[model samples]
Target: MSRILAFIFRRRGHGRGWHWTDIATWIWLIGGTILMFGPALWLVASSFKGPAQLAEFPPTLLPYVQQTAMVEGYDAPLPLYTTTQEDGSTKVLAEIRRIGVNSQMVDPGNPGERINVNIADRSPVREIGLATGNYVEPLVKNNFLRFLWNSVFVTVMATLITLFTNSMAAFALSKYRFRGRDGVMLLIVATLMVPLSVILVPLYSVVNAMGLLNSLWGVILPTVATPTGVFLLRQYMLTIPDELLEAARMDHASEWQIYWRIVLPLAAPALAVLAIFSVVWRWNDFLWPLIVLSQREHYTLQVGLNTYAGELNVQWHYILAMTVVTMIPVILVFLFLQRFITTGIAGAGIK
Candidate 1:
């Protein structure tokens, strides 16, 4: 451990000792790490706490519950507490019941007699405990698996369609020089400034006219053609030499063959970047899915998560637990494809 710490703090370039820049860099990194991961850690911790623990003021860092003991002649376990006696010594006692500011406690060893103590004179004995039920109960009671499947289907289908359609649009816009092509590209790019909220009603009308309401296809089809994706892929495809396509054409290759064999292979990094973006966007989208799918059976994960909130109460434990579950896929996708992001974005602007 000491050697590892020494190596970590070691100065680069044969410096004799630590420098001020090194100290600042380490401080900045540590602070950044805390800022990034602290809320996630807190969410995980809070997910394992029961309602009582969650409702406590100035929440604890770890899940905690009052310790309980099975006292003699009691049918159920009783909560334990440490009470300060008249002689200023403390004794562990099991609580029977509380009335007003006083509590009736019993010695676990001698359960026949009850001792009265002021609530202020005693504090409940608590130990770290995880409420696994927060994770289990929701799965058992709700249609969690169906919701997960719907989300997965939407994300996968939408990503594939986004990649295919965007790449095709990009191929044409970049390689082909038809009249009004610049105007077409400008119109597509300009759509980025138009917020989704502005088009929701018209989009919904189109989906409704097509009889796609309450259908997963409605969610997947409407969002597959994204201007951001077209822009990204087109910019990247522009960097590919036109000579490559001409060479393929000279070898008796069709346009589709050249696109499939030459262009896509070279633009893999950009496609990967677009794929990651599409997956995240489709998976986390809530409003469109909520508006389109009225039936509970067709609800996606984001829409399904809202069911935890009732008119009078919100089941935060279930919400937090399921939220953690929902994040696992997005996190895994990012970790898997994160390597291509820098390369793809940089290469896109080279031309």
Candidate 2:
């Protein structure tokens, strides 16, 4: 009987422990999800609100009321007469008489009277309203379509160039058995240690000398040869079997054929991952493009977004709206290629 009681107690304790662990895991998962997506949710919500709703006194989490104000004629000082009665009652007679402007009095017998007032002009009070005009006006005024095109053009071109350059370099390092190969690999790895800022001035001079400044190629060319890309691709390429290349060689296949048919297809997952990285980096790049490109027609989406923030007043709602729009493409790209990123990284161990 005692043995039976002990076994039952142990089983109940183990079950309770598993239940507690499951509950803790769920709490952590839900909290993390909320923390990650909270800002994105807020930005989307604020995009629909106006400046007043955005800058409401003691800010509102959700916009409940729309505030509107209009300017009316200014009020002038008027005279008032106070009379005391015998019973301690006071009567105040207020006349609508302007101190600065002239007024015309009408006689009780006369119905029509004309008057002209020559007074100092009061400054006009600006009216504030909660309207969608602020958000719509900027997109129409600023050529947003052109800015978007520029962003896509730069990102796509730069990403393609980076992928091609990095993949080729990676393949060479992985498959070739030439002298100084290790030294070359070391040199490329060493570049990852050097910050790009150190070479910015020299790079700028080179680009300027080549007359690439103010051109889209200027932005695309500098970022094409990335050390990180080469490193990532090389690591993945190491996993490819040399016997495959030898087999292709026995079939009288050229190096280009081996790369295109055998290696590239095998490396698709890694290439996709690299392409995603390159596209995202180039798309969101702001400072380099701002420095290199001067023309309004050539400005990328990020540079164009900067124009919304002015010296005196900033259009926060418009800025947030544009930001939300800009992030959509990157998010979409990530969603499309996320499988590649995860699978590639995981399969890296296999190779």
Candidate 3:
């Protein structure tokens, strides 16, 4: 036991060459990767499962495999009704008889009363299933595709608006010094500490007053200005040398030209990072979209997913598949912009 522990924890060779720490590090990495991605892989796989396969106590990972279950009331094969032949003759159709327990580990005591059945009459077995219809059924039955389109449009528009508004505010605060500038920034940043729940009623009233209820514009308009985005871009903008802006000014560059040509190009990294966050936020935004878009046809994907939830039994199969579908865009966005995330956040301090 002592040696085993030493092997796992202690250095193996001289001078830190291939120490146990390296092994431990690899082990940790592998374990963490599995822990993160295992459930995702499982959800994708489970979407393909048939009803019987899904209810298995310890669920199987691989789809499209035959499951030999020891069904209740069945020690031996039970006979199904006979099938008619071409000449109108009848033949007995029977289930496959098990000699002993099938899947003893899964069901040690699940077997039941023995009945006789013919081996020759048993039909050929089939795979578990792919169940592709789970994806299609939701789109067809609940107008899920429309909701997906709504989410895409809202998220895109809102993120674009957020980038423009936040970056403009940030550029002004960072580059152009003015009276009460610090006070204005402080006030805006302070809003970060205020909980959204506290202002929900007042904010909703304001939206309602604008006659924007039940519209996607209502959802997009409320979230266009994000404090975090402002702060991040402001800090990032501060890193830009004023000498460059001054040089451009000496060359007779207009304020708008300097902002458009100089500031925006340099701030692309921070914007990429902000875009990723904004997309994720608006994509998963359920509560606001639900409240604003009361009509079913105008629902976002997240809201439409709620259609799967019932008062009693939830549609786990469709939910699982749709959940996978929901995650794909976010994953793609992250994968595309992940290189900028660390640099953006690190350079653009939270303040």
Top lDDT hit: 1
Off by over 4 Å in 2: 1-14, 18-29, 61-136, 342-351
lDDT of 2 by residue, 165-225 (tens): 8999999999999999999989987987776578878888899999999999998898888
TM-score of model 3 relative to the true fold? Answer: 0.75
Clashes of each: 0, 0, 0
Number of the candidate with higher lDDT, 1 or 2: 1
Mind giving the per-residue lDDT tens digits that candidate 1 earns over 1-351? 999999988877878688788889999999999999898878988999988888889889899878999998899999999999999999999999999999999999899999999999999899999988888887778877788899999999999999999999999999999999989988996887776788999999999999999999999998988998998998889999999999899999999999999999999978888988788889999999999999988999899887665535887888888888888887787678766655655755421
Candidate 1 runs further than 4 Å off: 1-29, 65-125, 307-311, 334-336, 342-351
TM-scores for candidates 1 onward, in order: 0.78, 0.70, 0.75
Better of 2 and 3 by TM-score: 3
Worst 10 residues of 3 by lDDT: 101-110
Error of 1 at 63 (Å): 1.6
Reference-based lDDT, each prediction: 0.89, 0.72, 0.76
Clashes of 1: 0
- Residue range 30-120, candidate 3, lDDT tens digits: 8999999888888889987766567778877776534244446557434343434457675433344355432111122333333343333
